[model samples]
Target: MTGEDIYFAGVGDVHGEMYEMLGLLKKWESRLSFVLQVGDFEPHRHEADLQTMDAPGKYRKLGSFAHFYNGSAVFPYPVWFIGGNHEPYGFLDRIANNTEIATNCYYLGRVGTVELAGLKIVGLSGIYKEHLFEKRPPIEEIDRHSNADYIGFTENEVLQGLEFQRADILLLHEWPRGLMTPDNRLDVIDPEMVGNEYARMLVDSLKPRLVLCGHMHRYFCHQIVWPDDTITRVCCLAHTRSGSNAVEIFRLSGNRSIESLRSLDER
Candidate 1:
Protein backbone atom coordinates (compact mmCIF):
# COMPACT_ATOMS: atom_id res chain seq x y z
CA MET A 1 0.00 0.00 0.00
CA THR A 2 1.39 3.33 -1.06
CA GLY A 3 0.33 6.90 -0.29
CA GLU A 4 0.58 8.04 -3.90
CA ASP A 5 -2.44 7.73 -6.17
CA ILE A 6 -2.39 4.79 -8.61
CA TYR A 7 -3.83 5.67 -12.02
CA PHE A 8 -5.25 3.01 -14.34
CA ALA A 9 -7.76 2.54 -17.18
CA GLY A 10 -10.16 -0.38 -17.64
CA VAL A 11 -11.97 -1.69 -20.74
CA GLY A 12 -14.07 -4.76 -21.27
CA ASP A 13 -14.76 -7.49 -23.83
CA VAL A 14 -12.20 -6.40 -26.35
CA HIS A 15 -13.29 -9.32 -28.54
CA GLY A 16 -10.04 -8.96 -30.52
CA GLU A 17 -10.24 -5.19 -30.84
CA MET A 18 -6.82 -4.35 -29.41
CA TYR A 19 -6.15 -1.46 -31.77
CA GLU A 20 -9.28 0.37 -30.63
CA MET A 21 -8.04 0.21 -27.05
CA LEU A 22 -4.57 1.31 -28.13
CA GLY A 23 -6.13 4.31 -29.83
CA LEU A 24 -8.12 5.18 -26.72
CA LEU A 25 -5.03 4.75 -24.57
CA LYS A 26 -3.18 7.16 -26.84
CA LYS A 27 -5.83 9.78 -26.23
CA TRP A 28 -5.38 9.45 -22.45
CA GLU A 29 -1.75 8.32 -22.43
CA SER A 30 -0.48 11.25 -20.41
CA ARG A 31 -2.67 10.39 -17.42
CA LEU A 32 -2.81 6.59 -17.37
CA SER A 33 -0.45 4.25 -15.52
CA PHE A 34 -1.89 1.02 -16.94
CA VAL A 35 -4.96 -0.50 -18.67
CA LEU A 36 -7.08 -3.51 -17.80
CA GLN A 37 -9.23 -5.35 -20.37
CA VAL A 38 -11.85 -7.39 -18.51
CA GLY A 39 -12.70 -10.26 -20.88
CA ASP A 40 -13.37 -11.68 -24.39
CA PHE A 41 -9.64 -11.13 -24.87
CA GLU A 42 -9.45 -13.66 -27.76
CA PRO A 43 -5.72 -14.44 -27.73
CA HIS A 44 -5.32 -16.78 -30.68
CA ARG A 45 -1.64 -17.71 -30.29
CA HIS A 46 -1.40 -19.55 -33.61
CA GLU A 47 -3.68 -19.66 -36.63
CA ALA A 48 -4.00 -23.39 -36.14
CA ASP A 49 -5.28 -23.02 -32.61
CA LEU A 50 -8.41 -21.38 -33.97
CA GLN A 51 -9.22 -24.51 -35.90
CA THR A 52 -8.24 -26.75 -33.01
CA MET A 53 -10.76 -24.95 -30.89
CA ASP A 54 -13.29 -25.71 -33.66
CA ALA A 55 -13.97 -22.06 -34.30
CA PRO A 56 -16.06 -21.29 -37.34
CA GLY A 57 -14.27 -21.01 -40.66
CA LYS A 58 -15.53 -17.47 -40.97
CA TYR A 59 -14.03 -16.48 -37.62
CA ARG A 60 -10.79 -14.64 -38.20
CA LYS A 61 -7.78 -16.88 -37.95
CA LEU A 62 -5.61 -14.31 -36.18
CA GLY A 63 -6.22 -12.57 -32.89
CA SER A 64 -5.58 -8.91 -32.14
CA PHE A 65 -2.74 -9.87 -29.78
CA ALA A 66 -0.85 -11.50 -32.66
CA HIS A 67 0.58 -8.15 -33.70
CA PHE A 68 1.73 -7.44 -30.18
CA TYR A 69 3.11 -10.96 -29.80
CA ASN A 70 5.16 -10.66 -33.00
CA GLY A 71 6.65 -7.31 -31.98
CA SER A 72 5.14 -5.56 -34.98
CA ALA A 73 3.55 -3.00 -32.67
CA VAL A 74 3.80 -2.30 -28.95
CA PHE A 75 1.24 -1.04 -26.48
CA PRO A 76 2.20 2.35 -25.02
CA TYR A 77 1.53 1.07 -21.47
CA PRO A 78 1.10 -2.20 -19.66
CA VAL A 79 -2.19 -4.00 -20.44
CA TRP A 80 -3.46 -6.88 -18.32
CA PHE A 81 -6.45 -9.13 -19.04
CA ILE A 82 -8.48 -12.14 -17.92
CA GLY A 83 -10.16 -14.68 -20.20
CA GLY A 84 -13.81 -14.78 -21.24
CA ASN A 85 -15.85 -17.60 -22.79
CA HIS A 86 -14.87 -16.66 -26.35
CA GLU A 87 -11.08 -16.86 -25.84
CA PRO A 88 -8.79 -19.57 -27.17
CA TYR A 89 -8.44 -21.74 -24.10
CA GLY A 90 -5.80 -24.04 -25.61
CA PHE A 91 -3.30 -21.21 -25.90
CA LEU A 92 -4.26 -19.61 -22.60
CA ASP A 93 -3.87 -22.89 -20.74
CA ARG A 94 -0.14 -22.99 -21.49
CA ILE A 95 0.60 -19.61 -19.92
CA ALA A 96 -2.40 -19.41 -17.59
CA ASN A 97 -0.40 -18.04 -14.66
CA ASN A 98 0.50 -14.38 -15.16
CA THR A 99 2.33 -14.79 -18.48
CA GLU A 100 3.62 -11.72 -20.23
CA ILE A 101 2.84 -11.82 -23.96
CA ALA A 102 4.17 -8.46 -25.17
CA THR A 103 6.58 -5.91 -23.76
CA ASN A 104 4.17 -4.94 -20.98
CA CYS A 105 1.04 -7.05 -21.60
CA TYR A 106 -0.05 -9.96 -19.43
CA TYR A 107 -2.77 -12.61 -18.99
CA LEU A 108 -3.77 -12.80 -15.29
CA GLY A 109 -4.33 -16.58 -15.07
CA ARG A 110 -7.57 -18.46 -14.41
CA VAL A 111 -7.25 -17.76 -10.69
CA GLY A 112 -4.35 -15.68 -9.42
CA THR A 113 -3.03 -12.24 -8.57
CA VAL A 114 -0.37 -9.96 -10.02
CA GLU A 115 1.08 -6.77 -8.66
CA LEU A 116 1.11 -3.87 -11.09
CA ALA A 117 2.85 -0.60 -10.24
CA GLY A 118 1.65 -0.45 -6.60
CA LEU A 119 -1.74 -2.18 -6.76
CA LYS A 120 -2.51 -5.80 -6.04
CA ILE A 121 -5.04 -7.19 -8.57
CA VAL A 122 -6.76 -10.56 -8.40
CA GLY A 123 -8.25 -12.24 -11.47
CA LEU A 124 -10.91 -14.90 -11.85
CA SER A 125 -10.68 -15.75 -15.57
CA GLY A 126 -13.83 -17.73 -16.42
CA ILE A 127 -17.58 -17.29 -15.95
CA TYR A 128 -19.71 -19.42 -13.63
CA LYS A 129 -21.93 -22.44 -14.37
CA GLU A 130 -23.60 -24.60 -11.73
CA HIS A 131 -23.22 -27.90 -13.61
CA LEU A 132 -19.60 -27.31 -14.46
CA PHE A 133 -18.70 -26.61 -10.86
CA GLU A 134 -18.22 -30.28 -10.05
CA LYS A 135 -16.72 -31.29 -13.40
CA ARG A 136 -15.56 -29.37 -16.46
CA PRO A 137 -14.08 -30.23 -19.78
CA PRO A 138 -10.34 -30.70 -19.81
CA ILE A 139 -8.54 -28.22 -22.07
CA GLU A 140 -8.41 -30.92 -24.75
CA GLU A 141 -12.11 -31.73 -24.52
CA ILE A 142 -13.00 -28.05 -24.78
CA ASP A 143 -12.50 -28.28 -28.54
CA ARG A 144 -15.71 -30.20 -29.02
CA HIS A 145 -18.34 -28.03 -30.67
CA SER A 146 -21.40 -29.77 -29.32
CA ASN A 147 -20.66 -28.84 -25.74
CA ALA A 148 -21.70 -25.42 -24.56
CA ASP A 149 -19.15 -22.70 -25.25
CA TYR A 150 -19.66 -21.08 -21.88
CA ILE A 151 -16.25 -21.01 -20.16
CA GLY A 152 -16.39 -21.78 -16.47
CA PHE A 153 -14.53 -23.00 -13.41
CA THR A 154 -14.08 -26.48 -12.05
CA GLU A 155 -14.65 -26.87 -8.31
CA ASN A 156 -10.90 -26.67 -7.79
CA GLU A 157 -10.61 -23.30 -9.52
CA VAL A 158 -13.41 -21.82 -7.43
CA LEU A 159 -11.63 -23.08 -4.33
CA GLN A 160 -8.47 -21.33 -5.47
CA GLY A 161 -10.23 -17.95 -5.24
CA LEU A 162 -10.96 -18.67 -1.58
CA GLU A 163 -7.23 -18.85 -0.82
CA PHE A 164 -6.66 -15.13 -1.35
CA GLN A 165 -6.76 -13.21 1.90
CA ARG A 166 -7.39 -9.83 0.26
CA ALA A 167 -6.66 -7.60 -2.71
CA ASP A 168 -6.81 -3.97 -3.76
CA ILE A 169 -8.97 -4.85 -6.75
CA LEU A 170 -10.72 -7.85 -8.27
CA LEU A 171 -10.84 -8.12 -12.09
CA LEU A 172 -13.42 -10.69 -13.01
CA HIS A 173 -14.82 -11.75 -16.40
CA GLU A 174 -18.44 -11.77 -15.22
CA TRP A 175 -20.48 -9.85 -12.65
CA PRO A 176 -21.22 -11.54 -9.34
CA ARG A 177 -24.82 -12.67 -8.80
CA GLY A 178 -27.08 -10.49 -6.63
CA LEU A 179 -24.57 -7.64 -6.25
CA MET A 180 -26.12 -5.00 -8.47
CA THR A 181 -28.38 -2.13 -7.48
CA PRO A 182 -31.23 -1.39 -9.86
CA ASP A 183 -30.79 1.47 -12.30
CA ASN A 184 -33.36 1.61 -15.12
CA ARG A 185 -30.71 2.71 -17.59
CA LEU A 186 -28.44 -0.24 -16.92
CA ASP A 187 -29.40 -3.77 -17.92
CA VAL A 188 -26.99 -5.45 -15.49
CA ILE A 189 -29.51 -4.84 -12.73
CA ASP A 190 -32.06 -7.06 -14.42
CA PRO A 191 -32.22 -10.65 -13.28
CA GLU A 192 -31.21 -11.93 -16.73
CA MET A 193 -27.92 -10.05 -16.60
CA VAL A 194 -27.01 -11.29 -13.15
CA GLY A 195 -23.69 -13.14 -13.14
CA ASN A 196 -22.62 -16.34 -11.47
CA GLU A 197 -22.77 -17.61 -7.89
CA TYR A 198 -19.11 -18.65 -7.63
CA ALA A 199 -18.10 -15.07 -8.27
CA ARG A 200 -20.44 -13.84 -5.57
CA MET A 201 -18.92 -16.35 -3.14
CA LEU A 202 -15.42 -15.09 -3.87
CA VAL A 203 -16.52 -11.50 -3.40
CA ASP A 204 -18.19 -12.46 -0.14
CA SER A 205 -14.97 -14.08 1.07
CA LEU A 206 -12.25 -11.79 -0.30
CA LYS A 207 -14.11 -8.46 -0.09
CA PRO A 208 -11.72 -6.53 -2.29
CA ARG A 209 -11.91 -2.77 -2.30
CA LEU A 210 -13.19 -2.75 -5.89
CA VAL A 211 -14.52 -5.29 -8.41
CA LEU A 212 -14.56 -4.87 -12.20
CA CYS A 213 -16.25 -7.12 -14.77
CA GLY A 214 -17.87 -6.95 -18.28
CA HIS A 215 -19.36 -10.09 -19.75
CA MET A 216 -22.81 -8.47 -19.84
CA HIS A 217 -21.56 -5.79 -22.24
CA ARG A 218 -23.04 -2.87 -20.37
CA TYR A 219 -21.87 -0.16 -18.01
CA PHE A 220 -23.12 -0.34 -14.44
CA CYS A 221 -22.04 0.48 -10.90
CA HIS A 222 -23.24 -1.06 -7.65
CA GLN A 223 -22.20 -0.99 -4.02
CA ILE A 224 -21.66 -4.39 -2.48
CA VAL A 225 -22.27 -4.59 1.26
CA TRP A 226 -20.73 -7.65 2.83
CA PRO A 227 -21.90 -9.51 5.90
CA ASP A 228 -19.16 -7.76 7.88
CA ASP A 229 -20.61 -4.36 6.89
CA THR A 230 -17.72 -3.53 4.56
CA ILE A 231 -18.66 -2.12 1.15
CA THR A 232 -17.03 -2.79 -2.24
CA ARG A 233 -17.75 -0.98 -5.47
CA VAL A 234 -18.40 -3.19 -8.47
CA CYS A 235 -18.23 -1.72 -11.94
CA CYS A 236 -19.51 -3.61 -14.97
CA LEU A 237 -17.85 -2.09 -18.01
CA ALA A 238 -19.24 -2.14 -21.54
CA HIS A 239 -17.84 -4.17 -24.36
CA THR A 240 -15.47 -2.64 -26.92
CA ARG A 241 -17.53 -1.43 -29.84
CA SER A 242 -17.61 1.59 -32.10
CA GLY A 243 -18.86 4.65 -30.23
CA SER A 244 -19.30 2.68 -27.01
CA ASN A 245 -18.58 3.83 -23.46
CA ALA A 246 -16.24 0.95 -22.89
CA VAL A 247 -13.13 2.62 -21.50
CA GLU A 248 -13.09 3.88 -17.93
CA ILE A 249 -10.23 5.17 -15.78
CA PHE A 250 -9.75 5.16 -12.04
CA ARG A 251 -7.29 6.50 -9.49
CA LEU A 252 -6.65 4.54 -6.35
CA SER A 253 -5.54 6.73 -3.46
CA GLY A 254 -3.53 5.07 -0.73
CA ASN A 255 -4.43 1.35 -0.94
CA ARG A 256 -8.21 1.11 -1.21
CA SER A 257 -9.66 4.59 -1.67
CA ILE A 258 -10.86 5.38 -5.19
CA GLU A 259 -9.87 8.97 -5.84
CA SER A 260 -11.66 9.08 -9.18
CA LEU A 261 -13.63 7.08 -11.74
CA ARG A 262 -14.36 8.53 -15.17
CA SER A 263 -14.41 7.78 -18.87
CA LEU A 264 -11.02 7.55 -20.52
CA ASP A 265 -12.24 8.69 -23.91
CA GLU A 266 -14.51 11.70 -23.83
CA ARG A 267 -16.51 10.40 -26.76
Candidate 2:
Protein backbone atom coordinates (compact mmCIF):
# COMPACT_ATOMS: atom_id res chain seq x y z
CA MET A 1 0.00 0.00 0.00
CA THR A 2 1.16 3.52 -0.84
CA GLY A 3 0.80 6.69 1.22
CA GLU A 4 -2.24 7.62 -0.85
CA ASP A 5 -3.84 4.23 -0.33
CA ILE A 6 -6.60 4.03 2.28
CA TYR A 7 -7.06 0.92 4.37
CA PHE A 8 -10.20 0.22 6.37
CA ALA A 9 -11.91 -2.63 8.18
CA GLY A 10 -15.48 -3.86 7.92
CA VAL A 11 -16.92 -5.83 10.84
CA GLY A 12 -19.86 -8.18 11.05
CA ASP A 13 -22.69 -8.42 13.58
CA VAL A 14 -21.19 -7.66 16.99
CA HIS A 15 -24.09 -8.83 19.12
CA GLY A 16 -22.76 -6.87 22.14
CA GLU A 17 -19.28 -8.40 22.18
CA MET A 18 -17.48 -5.08 21.90
CA TYR A 19 -14.33 -6.15 23.70
CA GLU A 20 -13.93 -9.19 21.48
CA MET A 21 -14.58 -7.19 18.35
CA LEU A 22 -11.99 -4.60 19.36
CA GLY A 23 -9.49 -7.30 20.13
CA LEU A 24 -10.04 -8.90 16.73
CA LEU A 25 -9.27 -5.62 14.94
CA LYS A 26 -6.37 -4.55 17.17
CA LYS A 27 -3.69 -5.86 14.82
CA TRP A 28 -4.81 -3.56 11.98
CA GLU A 29 -6.02 -0.57 13.99
CA SER A 30 -2.96 1.62 13.34
CA ARG A 31 -3.20 1.12 9.58
CA LEU A 32 -6.94 1.51 9.23
CA SER A 33 -8.54 4.81 8.25
CA PHE A 34 -11.76 3.79 9.98
CA VAL A 35 -13.91 0.79 10.89
CA LEU A 36 -17.37 0.16 9.47
CA GLN A 37 -19.53 -2.29 11.41
CA VAL A 38 -22.63 -3.99 10.06
CA GLY A 39 -25.39 -4.10 12.61
CA ASP A 40 -26.50 -5.86 15.82
CA PHE A 41 -23.71 -3.91 17.55
CA GLU A 42 -25.72 -3.57 20.78
CA PRO A 43 -24.08 -0.52 22.30
CA HIS A 44 -26.16 -0.40 25.42
CA ARG A 45 -25.21 2.11 28.12
CA HIS A 46 -26.84 0.25 30.99
CA GLU A 47 -29.30 -2.42 32.00
CA ALA A 48 -32.23 -0.15 31.21
CA ASP A 49 -30.78 0.38 27.79
CA LEU A 50 -30.45 -3.37 27.32
CA GLN A 51 -34.14 -3.77 28.04
CA THR A 52 -34.93 -1.69 24.99
CA MET A 53 -33.01 -4.07 22.72
CA ASP A 54 -34.96 -6.76 20.87
CA ALA A 55 -33.31 -9.97 22.04
CA PRO A 56 -34.05 -12.94 24.19
CA GLY A 57 -33.26 -12.59 27.92
CA LYS A 58 -30.46 -15.15 27.69
CA TYR A 59 -28.80 -13.19 24.91
CA ARG A 60 -29.13 -9.78 26.56
CA LYS A 61 -25.94 -9.32 28.54
CA LEU A 62 -24.74 -5.70 28.70
CA GLY A 63 -21.37 -6.60 27.15
CA SER A 64 -18.73 -3.86 26.84
CA PHE A 65 -20.53 -0.78 25.49
CA ALA A 66 -20.94 0.80 28.91
CA HIS A 67 -17.20 1.04 29.40
CA PHE A 68 -16.89 3.03 26.20
CA TYR A 69 -19.92 5.11 27.17
CA ASN A 70 -18.42 5.96 30.58
CA GLY A 71 -15.02 6.93 29.13
CA SER A 72 -13.23 3.89 30.51
CA ALA A 73 -12.38 2.50 27.08
CA VAL A 74 -11.81 4.61 24.01
CA PHE A 75 -12.34 3.32 20.50
CA PRO A 76 -9.07 2.51 18.72
CA TYR A 77 -10.38 4.01 15.48
CA PRO A 78 -13.37 5.94 14.21
CA VAL A 79 -16.24 3.44 14.09
CA TRP A 80 -19.36 3.99 12.01
CA PHE A 81 -22.30 1.58 12.18
CA ILE A 82 -25.90 0.99 11.20
CA GLY A 83 -28.56 -0.53 13.45
CA GLY A 84 -29.59 -4.17 13.22
CA ASN A 85 -32.58 -6.14 14.48
CA HIS A 86 -30.82 -6.19 17.83
CA GLU A 87 -30.02 -2.69 19.14
CA PRO A 88 -30.83 -0.24 21.90
CA TYR A 89 -33.80 1.47 20.31
CA GLY A 90 -34.81 3.26 23.51
CA PHE A 91 -31.58 5.24 23.55
CA LEU A 92 -30.88 5.55 19.81
CA ASP A 93 -34.42 6.76 19.10
CA ARG A 94 -33.81 9.77 21.34
CA ILE A 95 -30.94 10.93 19.17
CA ALA A 96 -31.11 12.39 15.68
CA ASN A 97 -29.90 10.61 12.55
CA ASN A 98 -26.13 10.31 11.92
CA THR A 99 -25.46 11.50 15.44
CA GLU A 100 -22.37 10.50 17.40
CA ILE A 101 -23.53 8.18 20.14
CA ALA A 102 -20.11 7.99 21.81
CA THR A 103 -16.62 9.33 21.33
CA ASN A 104 -15.43 8.37 17.83
CA CYS A 105 -18.54 6.25 17.27
CA TYR A 106 -21.49 7.16 15.04
CA TYR A 107 -24.82 5.64 14.23
CA LEU A 108 -25.85 5.98 10.56
CA GLY A 109 -29.56 6.11 11.47
CA ARG A 110 -32.33 4.51 9.37
CA VAL A 111 -31.00 5.90 6.10
CA GLY A 112 -27.74 7.81 5.86
CA THR A 113 -24.93 8.83 3.55
CA VAL A 114 -21.41 9.94 4.31
CA GLU A 115 -18.28 10.70 2.32
CA LEU A 116 -15.07 9.04 3.47
CA ALA A 117 -11.63 8.92 1.90
CA GLY A 118 -13.09 10.28 -1.36
CA LEU A 119 -15.70 7.51 -1.46
CA LYS A 120 -19.45 8.04 -1.28
CA ILE A 121 -20.82 5.66 1.38
CA VAL A 122 -24.47 4.97 2.02
CA GLY A 123 -26.15 2.85 4.72
CA LEU A 124 -29.65 1.54 5.36
CA SER A 125 -30.21 0.04 8.81
CA GLY A 126 -32.54 -2.78 9.88
CA ILE A 127 -34.09 -5.69 7.99
CA TYR A 128 -37.12 -5.56 5.68
CA LYS A 129 -40.48 -6.76 6.95
CA GLU A 130 -43.54 -6.50 4.72
CA HIS A 131 -45.90 -5.66 7.57
CA LEU A 132 -43.66 -2.94 8.99
CA PHE A 133 -42.44 -1.69 5.62
CA GLU A 134 -44.76 1.34 5.45
CA LYS A 135 -44.93 2.13 9.16
CA ARG A 136 -42.85 4.71 10.98
CA PRO A 137 -44.48 6.27 13.98
CA PRO A 138 -43.25 9.58 15.35
CA ILE A 139 -39.92 9.40 17.17
CA GLU A 140 -41.50 10.77 20.30
CA GLU A 141 -43.75 7.73 20.45
CA ILE A 142 -40.84 5.29 20.20
CA ASP A 143 -40.64 4.93 23.96
CA ARG A 144 -44.25 3.87 24.27
CA HIS A 145 -43.87 1.05 21.79
CA SER A 146 -42.39 -2.38 22.39
CA ASN A 147 -38.77 -3.06 21.45
CA ALA A 148 -39.91 -5.18 18.51
CA ASP A 149 -41.69 -2.22 16.94
CA TYR A 150 -38.47 -0.57 15.73
CA ILE A 151 -36.63 -3.57 14.29
CA GLY A 152 -37.53 -3.34 10.61
CA PHE A 153 -36.58 -0.90 7.86
CA THR A 154 -39.58 1.14 6.74
CA GLU A 155 -40.57 1.70 3.11
CA ASN A 156 -39.88 5.40 3.50
CA GLU A 157 -36.34 4.63 4.57
CA VAL A 158 -35.73 2.57 1.43
CA LEU A 159 -37.15 5.35 -0.74
CA GLN A 160 -34.83 7.80 0.98
CA GLY A 161 -31.85 5.50 0.30
CA LEU A 162 -32.72 5.35 -3.42
CA GLU A 163 -32.01 9.09 -3.74
CA PHE A 164 -28.27 8.49 -3.82
CA GLN A 165 -27.06 8.44 -7.44
CA ARG A 166 -24.12 6.18 -6.76
CA ALA A 167 -22.01 4.84 -3.92
CA ASP A 168 -18.56 3.43 -3.49
CA ILE A 169 -19.80 1.33 -0.60
CA LEU A 170 -23.28 0.48 0.65
CA LEU A 171 -23.83 -0.83 4.21
CA LEU A 172 -26.78 -3.04 4.98
CA HIS A 173 -27.78 -5.27 7.90
CA GLU A 174 -29.21 -8.00 5.70
CA TRP A 175 -28.07 -9.56 2.43
CA PRO A 176 -29.75 -8.59 -0.84
CA ARG A 177 -31.67 -11.07 -2.97
CA GLY A 178 -30.13 -13.00 -5.94
CA LEU A 179 -26.78 -13.57 -4.22
CA MET A 180 -27.48 -17.28 -3.86
CA THR A 181 -27.04 -19.55 -6.90
CA PRO A 182 -26.58 -23.31 -7.20
CA ASP A 183 -22.81 -22.92 -7.23
CA ASN A 184 -22.73 -20.95 -3.94
CA ARG A 185 -25.63 -22.41 -2.03
CA LEU A 186 -24.89 -23.25 1.62
CA ASP A 187 -26.67 -25.94 3.56
CA VAL A 188 -26.91 -23.61 6.55
CA ILE A 189 -29.15 -21.08 4.76
CA ASP A 190 -32.11 -21.83 2.58
CA PRO A 191 -31.65 -20.39 -0.92
CA GLU A 192 -35.12 -18.90 -1.10
CA MET A 193 -35.12 -17.41 2.44
CA VAL A 194 -31.70 -15.79 2.43
CA GLY A 195 -32.15 -12.21 1.13
CA ASN A 196 -34.67 -9.42 0.59
CA GLU A 197 -35.93 -7.80 -2.65
CA TYR A 198 -35.71 -4.19 -1.39
CA ALA A 199 -31.99 -4.61 -0.81
CA ARG A 200 -31.56 -6.07 -4.32
CA MET A 201 -33.38 -3.05 -5.76
CA LEU A 202 -31.03 -0.71 -3.89
CA VAL A 203 -28.00 -2.53 -5.30
CA ASP A 204 -29.40 -2.44 -8.86
CA SER A 205 -30.34 1.23 -8.58
CA LEU A 206 -27.37 2.65 -6.73
CA LYS A 207 -24.89 0.35 -8.44
CA PRO A 208 -22.38 0.64 -5.65
CA ARG A 209 -18.96 -0.87 -6.11
CA LEU A 210 -19.22 -2.75 -2.79
CA VAL A 211 -21.95 -3.83 -0.41
CA LEU A 212 -21.25 -5.00 3.19
CA CYS A 213 -23.77 -6.79 5.35
CA GLY A 214 -24.20 -9.04 8.42
CA HIS A 215 -27.32 -10.38 10.30
CA MET A 216 -27.21 -13.87 8.76
CA HIS A 217 -24.04 -14.68 10.74
CA ARG A 218 -22.30 -16.38 7.84
CA TYR A 219 -19.56 -15.24 5.52
CA PHE A 220 -20.12 -15.32 1.76
CA CYS A 221 -19.00 -13.26 -1.20
CA HIS A 222 -20.68 -12.80 -4.57
CA GLN A 223 -20.48 -10.44 -7.51
CA ILE A 224 -23.27 -8.92 -9.59
CA VAL A 225 -22.33 -7.97 -13.12
CA TRP A 226 -24.54 -5.38 -14.78
CA PRO A 227 -25.29 -5.41 -18.52
CA ASP A 228 -22.68 -2.68 -19.00
CA ASP A 229 -20.09 -4.92 -17.28
CA THR A 230 -20.02 -2.80 -14.15
CA ILE A 231 -19.50 -5.11 -11.17
CA THR A 232 -20.77 -4.79 -7.59
CA ARG A 233 -19.19 -6.95 -4.93
CA VAL A 234 -21.29 -8.11 -1.99
CA CYS A 235 -19.73 -9.55 1.15
CA CYS A 236 -21.85 -11.06 3.90
CA LEU A 237 -20.06 -11.55 7.22
CA ALA A 238 -20.48 -13.86 10.17
CA HIS A 239 -21.06 -12.81 13.77
CA THR A 240 -18.21 -12.11 16.22
CA ARG A 241 -18.41 -15.68 17.51
CA SER A 242 -16.85 -16.87 14.27
CA GLY A 243 -13.66 -14.88 14.97
CA SER A 244 -11.68 -13.81 11.88
CA ASN A 245 -14.50 -14.59 9.45
CA ALA A 246 -16.40 -11.70 10.99
CA VAL A 247 -13.97 -9.09 9.66
CA GLU A 248 -12.57 -8.09 6.29
CA ILE A 249 -10.09 -5.45 5.19
CA PHE A 250 -10.04 -3.31 2.09
CA ARG A 251 -7.35 -1.21 0.50
CA LEU A 252 -8.46 1.58 -1.80
CA SER A 253 -6.47 3.87 -4.05
CA GLY A 254 -6.57 7.66 -3.98
CA ASN A 255 -8.97 7.47 -6.88
CA ARG A 256 -11.42 5.66 -4.54
CA SER A 257 -11.32 2.35 -6.37
CA ILE A 258 -10.61 -0.85 -4.47
CA GLU A 259 -7.07 -2.08 -4.98
CA SER A 260 -7.17 -5.15 -2.76
CA LEU A 261 -9.62 -6.91 -0.44
CA ARG A 262 -9.27 -9.90 1.87
CA SER A 263 -10.85 -11.46 4.92
CA LEU A 264 -8.94 -11.88 8.17
CA ASP A 265 -9.49 -15.62 7.96
CA GLU A 266 -7.71 -15.85 4.60
CA ARG A 267 -4.35 -16.52 6.18
Best prediction by TM-score:
2
Candidate 2 residue runs with Cα over 4 Å from true position = 263-267
Residue lDDT tens for model 2, 112-152: 98887888889999998777798956656767877788889
User: What tens-digit string does per-residue lDDT give for candidate 1 at 21-67?
Assistant: 77765667776788888878776656765643324657554767778
Best by lDDT: 2
- Return the number of clashes found in candidate 1: 0
TM-score, candidate 1, is 0.85
Clash pairs detected, candidate 1: none
Evaluate all candidate structures by whole-model CA lDDT and list the values in order.
0.75, 0.87
Model 1 deviation from native, Cα RMSD in Å: 3.4
Please state the error at residue 205 of candidate 2 in Å: 0.6
Clashing pairs in 2: none
